[model samples]
Target: MADFPDAAPLATKLRNTLIQYYNIEENAWRIAKKTKDTTVWRKPSEEFCGYLYKTQGIVEDVTNRIVDHIRPGPYRLDWDSLMTSMDIVDEFEENCCVMRYTTAGQLWNIIAPREFVDFSYTTDHEEGLLSCGISLDYGEVGHNFVRGFNHPCGWFCIPLKDNPRHSLLTGFIQTDLRGMLPQSAVDTAMASTLTTFYSDLRKALKA
Candidate 1:
């Protein structure tokens, strides 16, 4: 666990904090949402948004292991770090680019360089130094919706109660933004890509 850099300690810290926060189930994300230190309690959308943002690769690692543990492959465990700035799911304001935070009667737009939006975050990978522009596809993050195959129950996409014809993605969402763009551009462009990712995931699942 110690060998995996931020993975071990963060998970441990997250686990403990969650217990104190929810005082219910010890699921991974419920804890994070409670401890976020944001003034307004974060919505589930925001918490998963942030988790998929930070631990972009962890899901695929767990997924691949689950698959490799079940089905072998020359498999690539995908991870993504892009954040969904906001969601206006109702009919009137769908797919609008909402900022990640709304405070002091304003939406906080996370200003960032184009490259950071494309590749890597200056705050994260570069450790406060300016990156020299790595690869072309550095920060372009992706989200996916795959059908379940012989896995757990309770996660199937059940259509909402009011709208039985339309379905809800009860399964989960995952992202993989590594090598998608430049590390420096990650800050500015996360929102649009996130919107696109959500749209794409919904479409993919519906198909």
Candidate 2:
């Protein structure tokens, strides 16, 4: 049962950080993995010991609809395979809320299931929509799950000017899955998980 004294400042910071990440030059990131539908890039994180991953792909949907499926909501839980469960712990004005969620183990459970409490915000950006969040050190860790921290993670969905039916979906993810896991395992799991995310989302939207 932890809470923020004020959400406005936190929301503002999250939005600004996400905008900055979106503006990062392409040369700063090195390609980590590429799939049929998505490409992932990674760079050393400024805030943590882990790497910040960037994933980009063209989604066959409008910006608003795509954002709906990504933001903290039922649609997200229904589509995101890594997210096993989610609950809204607190709600604030202007599409901001606190979410408690658990992720399934990756890399054949070598990473172990992890839980996080995050302050999530969804807002309009110059391109289209930005959905972002940062982990909070709130609540006691569940006995069965390791506590993980996310550092300034977000997604920007922008509509194509010529083809309004399609949108460019880009994401920035940096998760510190705290535990005794090896760095190599974490790196492999993250890249694989991110690429799978895009394929799953596309299938969900088509369904």
In candidate 1, clashing pairs total 29
Where is model 2 more than 4 Å wrong at Cα? none
Scored by lDDT, the top model is: 2
Error of 2 at 192 (Å): 0.7
Question: Per-residue lDDT of 81-134 in model 2, one digit per residue for the tens?
Answer: 899999998999759999999999888789899999999999888769999999
Cα deviation in Å at residue 185, candidate 1? 4.2
Misplaced by over 4 Å in model 1 are: 4-159, 164-185
For every model shown, the clashing-pair count is: 29, 0
Best by the TM-score measure: 2
lDDT, model 1: 0.23
